[model samples]
Target: MPDHAILTADAHRDLRVNTERSAASGDAVMSAMVVPDELRQVQNEYPILFRRNLEHDRFTALAMFGFEDGENLFLEGTRWAARYLPLSIAIQPFLIGRPEGADTGVRQVHIDLASPRLGSEGLRIFEEDGSPSPYFHAVVEKLGMLDAGYQASIGFLAALRRHDLLEPLSLEVPLADGSTHRLVGFHVIDEERLRALDPAAVAELHQAGHLMPIFMALASLANIGALVARKNQRLRHG
Candidate 1:
């Protein structure tokens, strides 16, 4: 359960967030939100896909970590097995929320006080003098980066929509125990459509810096094999 509250130095002076990778620390996740800026590096280790929100009619890019809910194949003991961690996962227990009566663009930091990661011991968020600590600064920086990345992603997503390049995807995996899992509700880049774009559109996309991420997202499909191998390894070891 989340007990979300505004993050303030006075109220959360003794609060700290655990950085370890474990279920108790809220690091056990199946997927994390991804942005265009991270597609190149994230595509190397995770499959990048788009998830649509039926209510809002919007699409969000995600980096798949596991085939099933509550399963994170990259988690190994107290450390994540991946060389790069998604910014969304790294910024756990902290979120950007709207301030009361504020307009749409107003964003404020909110903390999940009930998160298992919250404890008395860990990186201090505030010093004894009620000043932000180094850890706090780092978190703020990362949060800012996340905000900017999301803002920039709007243009990238619009570009994809304009070209009708998003296509539904279905994944089927055979496990070691002879059971197969079917994954759905995700979308991917349509490579054929992308390649078939008119030269003028291609040049426009290239000028907008969206071409690399499109290819990167398509390339991430190769990591699906690695994910399956990891799941099978876990099943055999268990």
Candidate 2:
């Protein structure tokens, strides 16, 4: 028997590698101001939400997304929130400011579940429950997925499934241009926040006694640890 079996037939999983972004140089975009009215445009290119106070094992903490104009600027965990979301892609070892290496530098793997070919139920799950997920507002309302956050989440999740991993513990996200999306068909969520949000729902899945979640979580972490090692090595020699 495999260590991690599929929690649901639609779970997503994958391995990715990338180096972190470059450091602040002569005149980097230190900060920018954004307003609720401008959120749509800003998130278009920078889909992932992040804040200065929150620290993901592999992200820089800074208030870069929101507005400095004083009308709800994104402050990350304090304002913009992000974490090791449940998906199925491994994006890490990104080279921003540091020299690149072979799986040598830290890699950020994005794990998610998404597919253009999904059922109605699948799509509903994602929108109903997801963090930093303003994407849902329009979804359930039968409005539209014109929101950037919603679209990014959907595309990112679907991309994961296209990559191979099954989607589990899913949610439905919207896409730009007013399109509904069944992001992760299902994904293993092992975060405290998730647990806190929906213990009953998770418990139901656990009762099924599937190790898929554990495997998914560990797989992502193992990949991260490997990249961290390479990063540490480079820093040590430098």
CA lDDT of each prediction against the hidden true structure? 0.90, 0.28
lDDT of 2 by residue, 126-227 (tens): 322232123222332321222223334334333223333332344343333354334231233235443343566446444533223223332332332332
Tell me the spans in candidate 2 whose CA falls farther than 4 Å from its real position.
Answer: 1-21, 25-203, 206-211
For candidate 1, the per-residue lDDT at 200 reads: 99
Residue 143 alpha-carbon offset, candidate 2, angstroms = 15
| Best candidate according to lDDT | 1
Report how far residue 219 has shifted in candidate 2, in Å.
Answer: 2.5
TM of each candidate vs. truth: 0.95, 0.19
- Please provide, for model 1 over 68-185, each residue's C-alpha lDDT reduced to its tens digit, 9 standing for 90 to 100: 8999999988989988888888777888888778897888988888889889878888899899999888888878888888998999999999999999998889999899999999
**What TM-score does candidate 1 get on C-alpha atoms?**
0.95
Model 1: which ten-residue window has the lowest total lDDT?
87-96
RMSD of each: 1.4, 23.8
